[model samples]
Target chain A: MEQELISKKELLELTKISYGQLYRWKRKNLIPEEWFIRKSTYTGQETFFPKERILDRIEKIKNMKGDVSLDELANMLSPNLTELVRKREDLIKLNIISKSTLEFYTEERGKDKELNFEKILYLSILDNLFDSGKINFDEGKLILTFLDEYYPKFKGKNCELLFLRKLGISSCCLVSKPNEINFENSMKVVEKLNISDLIEELKIKLV
Target chain B: MEKNMMNLEIKGSGSSEGGKYNTVVIKGNGKIDGNLDCNYLEVQGHCEVNGNVKSESVKVNGNNSIKGDLEADEIEIHGEVNVDGNLSVEKIHTHGMISVNGNCNAESFTMEGAFKIRGLLNAGELELKLHGPSEAREIGGEKIMVKRNGRVKFTRIRKLIMPFGFDTGLTTDIIEGDEIYLEYTNAKVVRGNDIELGSGCNIKLIEYQNEFKQHEEAEVVTYKKIRKT
Candidate 1:
């Protein structure tokens, strides 16, 4: 999908953030380097950003500025999943994972000793899919096992989790970000989740 | 792992393997064959590292080259240093010259001679006393000050030896900062809150929010004051 683009000049005007704050955020790694798209204009070289994403990010940063330090903010927004461990009891207490789902996850993957960030994320994804009453228990287990085996390979990289159904038979696929795939008419896309966004969401929820 | 937990000292023409060390001192021609992780790295002569250099503090008084990225808390350069990849440091103080083929990120950067960065130079507080031709693709900082130091005492001998005269200016495509004071800088666009175009600056377009000052010798094609909002 084509995203709306906004120039750096217009963004600063709309956001009311000075150049200093913008660069400072960039230096602090709160703003990812890939977002600063350099394009040549009639006048000269100009910087542009994905309109919706950047605006939302700036809004979130502004809201969380006074409460947390920029370094903490950077960690929260960073694409790389930081090393975090959450107990299964805490996950249940926080209502992040349904009890049934947690029970199923532990049954398939042995006992839950200490759920790391990646494990929790995978559980949450499975729970989200299962809670919607779309996928069955078998498919959920498939996802859990698939993620457990393959997710580490994509660490610190942007990836997508795709759920597709062909004539009521569901299968999942994982691909790196900025990818385009065409499905046949018989295939239906059940759900597509950007792993990076999920990571950000899980990070915020954990915080 | 415990076999090489020691300091490395190369006095004359020698080569050593790179690894974790408490301190690495090279006084003469030395070569490091692998990645180096050290607490303190002091080079007084010519040295080449084939891999990345990670140190808490790096002091270079002579020529040194690194084929990979450099990460250090503090980097002090008194002679010349060259990096084939990116440079990330907390503080950088240079009285001679340094060049990087990739982006440079620093918290505080102070320079007296010159620098050439193939990519963006991003710093929190950037101060440059230009003594020779310096260039970067783009520059972004909080407070940036660029001034020309006449005569170029440190580089005078090199200048006299060369038949052609060098331009004592900073050339960048774009410069963005909070408060910028520039001299002898040629940039296509300059955007900041309070900008001062010192003598011998050639800017194509300038966008400022609060205040904009231009010297008589500076040539600015166009300028506009941004809205307060």
Candidate 2:
């Protein structure tokens, strides 16, 4: 079978990469060497890279670099900067906490002389439930009362209940008899919480 | 005997030398070194034709085997008919079944039962009502249609490269051993035991890596508009 040959100029044009950058990546062993197939002409030898391999390398580079260069940002904000940005994006997308809600939660917690983890967890759960359209304030309080009566023993252990209380949303009653309440309302309460953040944290801790 | 009703029953040779018949019916078992050329040819018992067959319509009731090619307007086989050469006909209807090791070109084909073919099938409209239990080495055509209620198994697809995509067809379930490369086509539903889509393959539905099924691994990518249909 006849082999289909392509020129280096064509590869560069297709990939939209500078010669210098291509060579630099090639030296770093980021792109496969076999992609640059060499052919001997009458005058001399020429090198050509496969279009697919070049494109794959470009995608890898994009993933490593975030929105802004690290050197461009201030030195103080450099620590855990990527993580903070990622978490913020995730929280916004998941609808766990709005910008205003986060400010409110922070202010309320800061004012408390003794930090009650249970109350904080309850507040977070309530915020998530409301945000997820799981429950309104009135329904949330009723559910919290049900939880207080039925599963009073479970009040302190499950931080989710505390997160709800901390968010100033009804927390206890709903957790105790979660099934008795409307499923949509229950989902709303859970959705309002930053479950994605919790899940990410769990994954980091466990895995 | 007249040329139209020349039912020549040759005990030694199956060839029709002196008679010119419109309808040639072979009664007993015989062998023909040369071809059989007539309007309508019917084989009641077992018969073998060494040379090519040129007729308007050919029907084999009993076991018939042809070494040379069969060229006719319409062909129907009720019993097992093995053709070593190519078969070219306007329309082919098989009831018992057919096993051909060569290619086939027909306008419209209907197979009531199973069939096993080694070479390509080039037809305008083809329908297989029964199951396809046998394996085919290679198959290529423009508008290939198949309706199989039973299991259709292919050991290997050396190259199932459909550049034009599937014009129109449906495989209820397909179990293949090799890869399937499809591009630029649409299908109602394709459920395979294991399926792999080559690069630049555009398909509609792909259910892959299913834990609950027997034929598990499935991968579909580099396509537009894919659902779990």
Candidate 3:
């Protein structure tokens, strides 16, 4: 049996991928490098790729789709995936827990608590999220969910509750109450809460 | 004569009487002191005109020179031309070298070879080719193009010059609503919203004055170390 040569257009159509994706895969070494053949023409010499190698590589990528990301797939077949997924997952989990914990502790501490354990936990979660690339400011509200389940007595404090709500945290109060509050008023509440101090504390603990 | 097919030829040293014609092809060396209003005029030999050359289209092939101003819908010069006065045309294509002492205002202008201008060069669409190596002290136009091995020089005075802004420097500068390509022979300082620098250009300085900073990554190659004087 003889192998057939395929054009880049044909290969892309068969693989159901864009030209950019195909080129990116080629760059990462996920696909087999193509062989170029020169053909002489009236104007100049044109170069073309061999079709067999491209088809074979496309088949391999189709088989590896479920097991790896495109970047990982690039290395697993030829070069090196470098264990990026495991490291990334670990970092993400660490950040989520650290930020959530800090928000929990801040709400738990009152006006004169010597040690704010809740703030510390929240900061730690933020640090973990930062490391994991999941450090969304909205995730700071997740602490309230954990607190509502854990501590029921801290609910009626408008300052602390509104502060969390303003930070885009999901809260039972926000869902129940519908009011048109401007950013200026929300910022005033934020200022009164002195979240900057908490943020400073977070920076010291997390960094 | 048919309105669509009107051919008027002047032989020997004769004068072209001012009249609107379809096609006027001057084969020999002739002179026209008055305005020439025609659809198309082709001059093969040397032609010295004293007045404005007005036509729908004009083509000068031989060593032709115009001492007076020119007004036409379209003008093409295939040979060397020395215009001592201003030239106003809709479209112009000069295959040979062109030297203009005064201003050149046109909608579209193209020079295949070298182009030299002593005064201001203004056009809605201007394309120039500095074939070997040329220089211009002060030049201004709407759209400009300098092929490979072309040089442009502009003297900087006390003035705020802005290139293009927001939009990429792909299109020419617009006045009210018109695309004009402004090409320089050597240097250019623009103060506009959008500006684009074509490839294969060696520029001294490019300054941008805007609130937002747009970063573009490009290959930087340092050739020599300089000392402040």
Candidate 4:
């Protein structure tokens, strides 16, 4: 979990974003309902947010809102399109999942295997990371296994895939609760990305 | 055949509930429910809102309580305001007391009164000559200025009933911006491009890109000026 909690007052002062915008975003579903985070303070009940996440989200919203409408922004933040199934050709046409990864996926899971949206997202993420020179092909396979095993467990939460490489060995972990994207002492972070942001990026590219 | 209603007035204990209008004026103790989207809103007597208030301009003279968020181009508060949600405006000139449970965002915030905000206070130009103690958890902007009136005294009697119980000094955590000017403030970290700290500021860290100047009386524990990357 992101541990640092910032009071709503502090958030507003720091961002200078008004309460109306925050609540409007809440109403529009641009921010996760769980992030509202009500806590008891000396002065009755006050709202708090996971500082890092909210700050990143608000910055994203501010930057993207000028280009898109509020409803579209809400759609971008909305999650759980994981079960939507797409054909292999459609996924390639959508320019999300690469052909090489799709070939590899079909080879392992069988050509006729019906992959859901989450599996496709994982494959797309792996393909993109490898193509961008962030992760090796073998490390990508580890990330795929990690995602296939653990990504589905997180229903509505935003999770990230982290590939840690150390001493000529690499391992991947799914972080449902991320803190600082730690690389430890000597571990190299191969590639890390929040799944929802990947989905949004794909959506933007599709649009 | 038609009424050119450019303004609206509620007088003599009259009350109305929610609608859209061009301009709204409440002279008597009035109440409104639902969304109030108008061009201008002025409250001279006690007024209460049960929903959001959006207008081009808002001027509050008497006590007003908003159950929902408030948004406007310009909001001038000379009396008292109690808001249960966020407050977004272009320019806010507050001379009395205002309490917002949510964030306060504006292009420019000019305050000479007691203000309590539960959320961030972000703006372009934040100028304040605080009448009483005011507080926000985080304060950031392009050009930030906060100075406590020299004549004001931090008496024990005044500290007893203040809204947030903030002492006469302004207290905050991280204050980062491009140009920051502070006086009589206590902050954990102050980072900016051009920072000039006035007297009586207690800042733990001052990370600047270009210039950093502190008054002789201001106390800054750590400060660094780094080259722009």
Candidate 5:
């Protein structure tokens, strides 16, 4: 899907933020570097941003400002995983994932009792998929295996989880920061989830 | 503890491998071969580092060069320094010259000599007293103030070097700040909230929010007031 873009001038006007504030946030790493797109126009070269994402981020920053320092805010907003170990029972009690999801994860992965940040993140993704009624248990196992094998290769980079069904043969793959992907007419894209967004959500839940 | 770490000192022309140190003092020509993490780095003579430098404080009295990025809490330069990568420091007090091939980020940057930054110079409070020609691709900060040092030494030196006059002002592509005051600067676009264009400023456009002032000799082509939402 093509992302809707908003010009820098329009973004500043809409958000009621000054140039200094925008640049300060950028320098503070509150804004990612890839989102600042430069394109040419009749007047000159101008900057653009993904419309919905920028608006949502600005709103979040404004709402969360003054309660925490900018560095803390940057840490919260970033997509990096925290070095934390969470108990399975406590996670269930926190309502981040259900007990059945944990059981399924253990059956496929291992019988390990300790749940690190990575395992919890995978479990949370499975829980989200199960809650949305998108994939079956077998498909969930495939996802877990795929993540266990290839997820580490990305090394904390932005990626996507693609679930495609070609003639009822459900297969999943991962792509890093995919801009565009084309599928044949017979292929069906069941569920496409951005892993960075999932990481952000999981981070909030863990907090 | 840092107190127990060994200090690396090169008294004459020598080379040392980089590592954790209490203090690194180079009195003559010295070369560091790897990343250096230290409490204090002082160079009274010439020094070169082939990797990144992470230090609490850095004091350079002679020529120094770093091949990688430099991260310091405080940096004071009385001579010349060059970095092939980015620079991130809390405070910088320079009276000589410093050049960076990448971006420069600081909390408070006060310069009285000259600088050439190929990338952005982002700071919280930036005060540049242009003793010589300075250049940056872009400058963005909270409060930016640039002024010319109207001393006779520079004029006398320029007269001795060349018969024709030269522009010792700052040259930048874009400058954006909340409070900005420019003197002897040539920029394409300047956007700020409260802006004052001093004499010898040649800007293509000026966009201000609250107030705007221009000196009589400043050559500004266009000015516009932006409404603050």
Candidate 6:
């Protein structure tokens, strides 16, 4: 099903963001240029945006405005990740990935080739989760496998990684949007995070 | 100019239920605290109104600030206007500036000055000679043409005391229509059935269905021909 959309007028009213501020953000690249969708109406052409995406983005920009500059936000938002490679020890020195996770990954993959940038970034996310005790090493393996298998399907779209744990068994799925998961049978949704968010956080730490 | 007309002159702070008046003129620093309904309105000095304004003809020679919407048959601005709401007019000819906090819907919109619009600018026919840097978040109409003003002329001395100078150009997020021609515009995306881009334009993408032409000096990142859906 297609998601509902809201007009520019309605979005301004709902967000209480002034026109100058909206335009300023657009110029700042905090909001992507393509989100402005035009449709002919009874009066004339009107601009609309996907309600969910815009609402989420607006909330994020508002929350992170004073924390970082608009240019920094734009850099974090852009999906272009440069293929800058770092070794296992360097990643550990940068505090991105831990020794334990690298050992586990080396144990999984044959320890003969240089790891690409994507695997390093994924390892960084799993390291955060593993260090914080959000998900176990098995769940981390599942996440890495999911990235290796399913991430290409998302290709330039906002996506989230969902993990559900029940009775010591944890599973993960990738979704375009987050949702409430109530299995109603003693199951709990362990963690839900955007893959891009992980990349953004990692980029920040690396920078 | 019309000394013979019965004018509602606001010399100081004033309020009106906004009845049908011949002309409402604000000569000095004036403020209207209520709705204004008049045939003609002229602001020669700084003015602030707290309510909606409906007029047949409005001329601004100074600064005008309104907190509500504006509806007029014809509006001629040689000064600045700041509206907090929408502007629905048949014709608007501005030689100064107009900043609208809401949408602007006009039949024939012509400007030789600058403007900053927070919302859409929808018109039947929109033509502008950009005096400086102007901006509209979104613009939609049947035919829209904008050209940068590069004529060398002696500006008025009164403008030296005003707050704004000539507009540099225009920056828009999106501009879409049936026929669109823009010069000295920097836009993210422009979609029209018939489109022409003149010089000094830096656009990211342009999707046209019918006819498309661009000047040699203009730069466009992407151009596509799409079938009408």
Fnat of each prediction?
0.61, 0.00, 0.00, 0.00, 0.45, 0.00
Q: What is the DockQ of candidate 3?
A: 0.01
Off by over 4 Å in 6: A1-207, B1-7, B11-20, B150-167
lDDT of 2 by residue, A136-202 (tens): 6565565444433543355322212322333454443323211133444333333322222343332
Looking at model 5, residue A205 earns an lDDT score of: 72
Q: Give per-candidate clash totals.
A: 0, 35, 43, 13, 0, 7
Ranking under TM-score, best-scoring first?
1, 5, 4, 6, 3, 2
Best by the DockQ measure: 1
On residues B34-130, what C-alpha lDDT tens digit does candidate 4 reach at each position?
8888888999989999999999899999899999999998999889999899988878998888889987878788988777887777777788886
Native contacts present in candidate 5, fraction = 0.45
Model 3 lDDT tens row, B1-229: 3467556778776876545667777778787766656677788987777766666778888876777777777878888878888766767898877777776656567777776666445554456654534444333343444443233342121112423311111111111101211233234322112334344333332322221111232111211221111
Q: State each model's C-alpha RMSD to the native.
A: 3.0, 27.9, 27.1, 11.4, 2.7, 21.0
TM-score of chain B of each: 0.92, 0.59, 0.63, 0.87, 0.95, 0.86
Highest TM-score, which number? 1
lDDT per residue for candidate 5 within A1-207, as digits (tens), equals 789999887898899998778878887888887898878775345679999989988998998897888988887778677787887778988998898898898888677767888888788878888888989999998888888898888747778888889977899888888467888999999888888878776776777
Q: What lDDT tens digits, residue by residue, belong to model 1 across residues A61-100?
A: 9999999999999989986887889988888998888999
lDDT by residue (tens digit), candidate 6, A1-207:
367899976786688664445654664556765677888875356679989978888888898889998878887776556465666677778877788988988877757345566777677767767887998777788888887898777755666777788888788877863344446678887776777767766766766
Off by over 4 Å in 5: A41-44, A109-114, A178-189, B1-3, B150-164
Alpha-carbon lDDT of model 5: 0.88
Candidates, DockQ: 0.74, 0.01, 0.01, 0.04, 0.52, 0.01
Candidate 2 CAPRI assessment class:
incorrect
The residue-by-residue lDDT of candidate 6 on B171-196, one tens digit each, is: 98888667889998988888777899
Q: What is the lDDT of residue B67 in candidate 1?
A: 97
lDDT of 3: 0.48
Task: Report the Cα lDDT for residue A190, model 3.
Answer: 26
